[model samples]
Target: MTYGKFAYVYDELMKDVPYDKWVDLVMKNTQKYNIQGKRLLDIACGTGELSIKFAKKGYHVTGVDLSEDMLMVAHSKAADNGMDIQFYQQNMAELEGLGQFDIIGIFCDSLNYLQSEQEVLDTFMHVYEHLDDKGLFIFDVHSIHKILQIFMNQTFTLNDEEISYIWNSYQGEFPNSVEHDLSFFVLDHKSGMYDRYDELHFQRTYPIEIYETWLREAGFEVVEVAADFESVSPQTQSERIIFICRKK
Candidate 1:
């Protein structure tokens, strides 16, 4: 998936996303697990949105992503905000060189982008390798219910003065996967015209049990599993599954 232009409009389209809920989740879980260190590694940290948030909260943040374009946007945002954050271009599955951190996050269901079970397992092992002995691994993913019941074969649209997009979701070749074909229109003030672009995004998710097993194989002890930012158990239709784990 190319994020050349999507990187620029991501934050604008995701303005309604409850980023702070992630912040609160991290803080509450870290405190609950008795982790007091501030260093954090944000994997697949697109545009550094949550990385910057963690930095503002006094965490020593390092952000990693697969897209150089996304890292560029993140770097610009960090510099503009006067926040000191380290941004790197690296795929989450092949993450390396970055040392252990007090906390590691793969938020925004970014893991769903991994195309294979081995990639997901590799990511879990890498996260285990790069986590402090007492650190926490916090991440979330689209639940099976959400992928099948909510996103499958859906068409979504947004029309605005500055930007607009038509998103079509259909079944992917892989099981429990969704492919999103998007066409975007952006108004240009310089010439009073609209620039059109297209991008395809692929996302797939597995059952929570599959993820739990991978976590164990990667030498992690599952601490908790939550749903939709709630502290209770995941219901039949919960859209998101959050995993809390520590180094085994």
Candidate 2:
């Protein structure tokens, strides 16, 4: 459950990600479905990046993540941008008491962190419970192909002005899973000091059919499954697969 230093540098390392595409896709779905309510809940909204964008689009946004450090950074960013976004620290699998939302989103492969079929089903059920009738539930996960082919034996590195990192991916001890061992060297600009931190994260994904089955069991009608950032069928070689569902 430790994000470690990656919790601090997550935004910087992911700066090149196409967050605008996520926003655009969500907006497009809202328009296509005639979803007019403004309330939105972003599950696993790490650092609240996409939540801020939704808020800018005139939606009342609430972001929930398990990491307090990430929530702190999210709060700072919201303050800096003069945005009124509510951030909560909670586990998605046990989320409760949050009133219904017109739309709920889990993006950036966040669902993979559940690491187990039961947890995934529980999370989906909770999401279903919290969504208003006929509401939209949009999420994306790393395709099984990506997990087996690209991430199973990958080593990636990133060097930046504030942080340098070595991310090593290995086959997980569990079946159909991957583990990430991340080492980060962060610099303190004012004090001229460097800090080293290590973190272990685990992610696992099932086939698209399994996800579809679980969504249906959780009271959602699968609306669409598309390639990442596009409303098209996902190819086998695609890295990410998106699922768009509507609550029954």
- Residue pairs that clash (backbone atoms under 3 angstroms), model 2: none
lDDT of 1 by residue, 66-167 (tens): 988899999999999999999988889999999889999999999999999999999999999999997999999999899899989999999999999999
- Which residues of candidate 2, in runs, are more than 4 Å off? none
Candidate 1, position 16, lDDT: 95
The candidate scoring highest on TM-score is: 1
* C-alpha RMSD values across all candidates: 0.7, 1.2
- Model 2: lowest-lDDT 10 consecutive positions: 1-10
Residues 42-118 of candidate 2 have per-residue lDDT tens digits of 99998889999999998899999989989998999999999988899999999998899999999889999996799
Residue 90 in candidate 1 has what lDDT? Answer: 88
Question: Which residues of candidate 1, in runs, are more than 4 Å off?
Answer: none
**Error of model 2, residue 37, in angstroms:** 0.5
Q: TM-scores of the models, in the given order?
A: 0.99, 0.96
